[model samples]
Target: MLVPLTREKFEQLIPLIATGPQYKYYWGKFSNFLQRLLISVVIGAIVLLFKVLFRVDFPLVFIIGIIGAFYWFWGPVFQASQRNIKCRRYKYSGFFRGRILDFWITEELIGKQETVNNKGDLVIVENREKRINLEIGDDTGFIAEFQAPLKVAYKAISSGQWAELLVMSNRGDLSTIEEISDIYIPSRDLWVSDYPILRRDFFTEVSSRLDDNEDEDDKPRRRRSEGNRRRKRDDYRY
Candidate 1:
């Protein structure tokens, strides 16, 4: 079942949604550049050590110059040039459909649902247990299983509601999800091409509901004031 919030709440919560991949790509490139820069420094130091130890006529000036050029120019240039490089585009035709709403997980509940396919006398069974439920928060409140929970969480950081998440699992367990809030999402690489329309719809409904609630709250006050005015007129006439 999709749950809708009022407009005010939707607006407040919309900001909490994770950011798209475009933002992640930018940061990812910057991080890669920093890593490369560090590696280059280490390589330069090794080259310097080799020149001193071997007493070889290594062109230290030329090598250092190239490294410097890569650091100051090539790194940023390569990153900027690749900005327009398209990775993979998802076609929203069939097979994959539906938008992602709110994602939540409780440690207490494991996979409970399972299904079987019927074929004549024999049947093939499979465990369709849901470890994570992605809430589309709409009229139906559609919930779906998230196959890649960690990736979903990473995407959620960009969506803006990273603080609401609380991950818990056993210590030393690599598969366990850990709660780490206030995480900065790297750039564009973090997003998928297929945008979740369900999430958008959910927020729209939430915003509408909030507006309705506000109107309802004002109605009673308006009626009370009108009643008081009527009572005052009656008292004066009497």
Candidate 2:
């Protein structure tokens, strides 16, 4: 089931901000931090060499500082900006309730590590980690696949659990899902995703409003059904 929210309301709940729990997921990763530092160092070294060997001007040296600053300080902000831009292109935000149809685990290459062999030679080895993949769908026939690292908490997830999503899509084309937040499993009170996107507090508030709307919509239909039953009873007596 899909309950639509206006774009303005959606943005109000999920504001475009550089720092949040979602940004923490990107900023807190040690591997990502190391990778960015390595790039900055390598580029800075090259630029320094240009200045020393080829007599490049001060602008080139200044560029090295800028590169380091970008990778170290402004990287997360840049990433957040890009995500916000992509999300803004979509015209609608929807509260999607669905069920987990199936799931599987697979070993994925996470990264590589350098290790010393018995012969005292350094060698690079592939690091593999387990990841869980899930297929979720609703009665409306919309199906989406989600993946997350296989952790102890996620091991409890099985088929037939309820899944909730904050889905973004264009008004003219709802069939194509532009983006989705982390999957929320209400039964287990667990969330699954490599990256967190939605603001949990705001999500809970929106969910309640949607549920109330559904209840309000059902009231008239229920009253009409009762009236029909009363009419049928009178005709039978006559």
TM-score winner: 2
Q: Write the per-residue lDDT of candidate 2 for residues 52-162, one digit (tens) a residue.
A: 898868875877667764685567766876776677677877778899999999999989999999999999999998999989998779898888888889978989998
Give per-model TM-scores.
Answer: 0.24, 0.71
What range of 10 consecutive residues in model 2 has the weakest lDDT sum? 229-238
* Model 1 lDDT, full chain set: 0.36
- Look at candidate 1 and tell me the lDDT of residue 164: 16
lDDT of 1 by residue, 1-238 (tens): 1122223332232233233432343335566768867866776677667667876775765577467546633554444334322111111111111344555544433345444546445443443433333432123332233422234544343232211111122332213323211111123323222222123333344334444644664675555565764453333210
Instruction: Give Cα-based local distance difference scores for all models.
Output: 0.36, 0.74
TM-score: model 2 vs. ground truth:
0.71
Model 2 CA deviation exceeding 4 Å by range: 30-71, 113-116, 120-124, 171-173, 218-238
* TM-score result, candidate 1: 0.24
